[model samples]
Target: DGSGFLAIFIIGMFVGNQNTRKVSYILPVGEGITWLAQISLFLMLGLLVSPHNMVHYVVPGTIVAVVMTFLARPAAVLLCLLPMYFRRYSIKDLLFMSFVGLRGSVPIVLAMYPVMDDISNAQLYFNMAFVVVIFSLLVQGACILPVAKFFNVYAPASVAPISKANVGIMLNDDFDLFNYKIKRDSMEGRRLRTLQFPKETAVVAMFRDGHLMKPQGGTQLKKDDILSVIGVESDEIALNAIFSQDKPVKQYPLYAGDKIYDGHTPMTLLAETYNFELTSFEKTLTVAECMSYHLGGFPQPGDFMNLINARLVVVSLEGDYIAKVGLYLLSEIRLKEHRRKNARSGVSTLSKYGQKSLHR
Candidate 1:
């Protein structure tokens, strides 16, 4: 009752949530202490149990371990997670969790309490607990990675930096310094400028074979090179996508002169990035869908639509679907005139060039 474990757990939860910055400073020290404590715990447990005594209980302990691993643990996981089925928990996730119910040092330590209190057959309990722990480690632990793989509950490999240093400055919360090691061969022969990173993201420093070098736009990326990048926090996803080999990178097209977007580009992204207006319902549509809707569901190359102050002209098509669109902003005088004519007409109309007016 007075073990202080519950108290420590409560304090840890409180501090972790309330003071994350302070907690980060102590993480390295806490990890070192945790490793030391685990080593000491196993050593102490090893000193208490004799291999001769453990041998007598091995058969029964193995049976108990099997039952727990195959039946009891799985049933318990199913019952607890069944209410969350489909919404938050999936069948494969539940199955994997049930299979990986590894018994740890806590049970062995609890077993010692019964023996110390002089309970009936406490030595039997201690020996059984020891055998169960050993069985769980040797059998269940060994098979965990294979089971996880079989369930497809694994993340693709990513290269983490060898070192990180936080740079403290004004408005630091909005920005971050990321150091990534280029481990994949996909980016090995590509130049830095060709990678199409996010606008606010830049690679500032590069190190090859332990020698620091300045990174230029034309510098080619090589495997095992460590690069220090500085970018805003929102650019993290785009940066990760650029570095990832297995995942497809989402394209972030610019709104500069003569730039065209693929048909698949989201209209909502365009509106938000370029200050274009869109209705709540229209926000869910893509550029191709909007253009096709304006053109009466049959769009061809060079067909244009007048959307607010910009003209969206279909540039190309992949079969019947619009594949590319070029955007051109109207002059201030033309935009005012277009709006005045729409207000006076009080009806949706099509122009001579087959351009639909979406003003109303």
Candidate 2:
């Protein structure tokens, strides 16, 4: 089935959806799985290539790889992204995504025959494939984010699960939360406001023994609180710094009656409440985003479709205070359930956090 292009188109839609301003964080498990699948394919194909055979075709294969990564991939991305109406994806994000286009397992498996069977100049074919793969990995992997910024698809800052040993608790088909177990006795009793992290991260919620912690500043801490946080891919470094510190996290001063809730404000302002960005901002919408939100992907509290009791109480007739509270509250509930189900099987609620709009 030439459905390969169709599948790619669909995947692009999903990836583009996650790049939107309100929802852009990818599922940690899915992201990791993609890498795993790619690697597995590569390994399977590696058995097919012999060094002598690969060396000959190396140069031509590199040319093909470069063309695929630089030209074909970017063109596909532009086709998929242009309709979404994004303004942020700069030349950089396009360039980087294009660069990282590794021809992993599928190509390897397909290449096996050329290496095994005497196709004219077998070594040349093998070598070129190797060269292409290297170019994809080295040039592209090295610059994923920088390119994201250029493409204007770089995600917002917030707490994120460690990519290496990440644990995502799927609350249901719609929502999920990524978990990182903070070592016990570290940062015990510290207010949520005290954690030191970069602007590129957010601590969405916390948990203990699988029970969700209130997404509140006053929420006290205990050993082994399983923190459920949301952040862009970049915030991982800062997240590591905060959790690794472990001691009573230094507290930031809160003025009298200071509330973290800011109404329909710039993402930068709203994001200050958590350790990361409130949502990854994309100026445009793609077909996948429309399908995911089911209401044409408007970025308002009203857009938060099913937050139940959630309300977007506008502080100044502008902010979706209701949606904000709803997200925070949902985050709390999800955190608790994740804790209860930590060692057991449970659905993940992280994906459900923002689908509800609080226009009411």
lDDT of 2: 0.49
Q: With candidate 1 superimposed using the best TM-score fit, by how many Å does residue 148's alpha carbon deviate from the native?
A: 2.0
Find the candidate with the highest lDDT and give its number: 1
The 0-to-1 C-alpha lDDT of every candidate, in the order given, reads: 0.69, 0.49
lDDT of 2 by residue, 307-328 (tens): 3332122112133122232233
Q: How well does candidate 1 match the true structure, expressed as C-alpha RMSD?
A: 15.9
Residue 323 in model 2: lDDT: 29
User: What's the residue-level lDDT of 144 in candidate 1?
Assistant: 82
Residues 1-360 of candidate 1: C-alpha lDDT, one tens digit per residue: 575988887887776554233454666687898799778878877887888787788889899988887788778877777777769878899888877754667877788888789999898888888877877888888888888899999766555444544444433243567888887777765556457667666677777778666554334567888879887556666667677774433433322225688999999988876676776777788999977765553454445666555777777789778898888777778767755654443322233222423444
Per-candidate count of clashing residue pairs (backbone under 3 Å): 0, 79
User: Candidate 1: misplaced stretches above 4 Å?
Assistant: 1-3, 17-19, 82-87, 169-176, 196-201, 231-360
Candidate 2, which ten residues in sequence have the lowest lDDT sum?
311-320
- The alpha-carbon lDDT assigned to residue 226 of candidate 2 equals 75
Please name the candidate that would achieve the greatest TM-score relative to the true structure.
Answer: 1
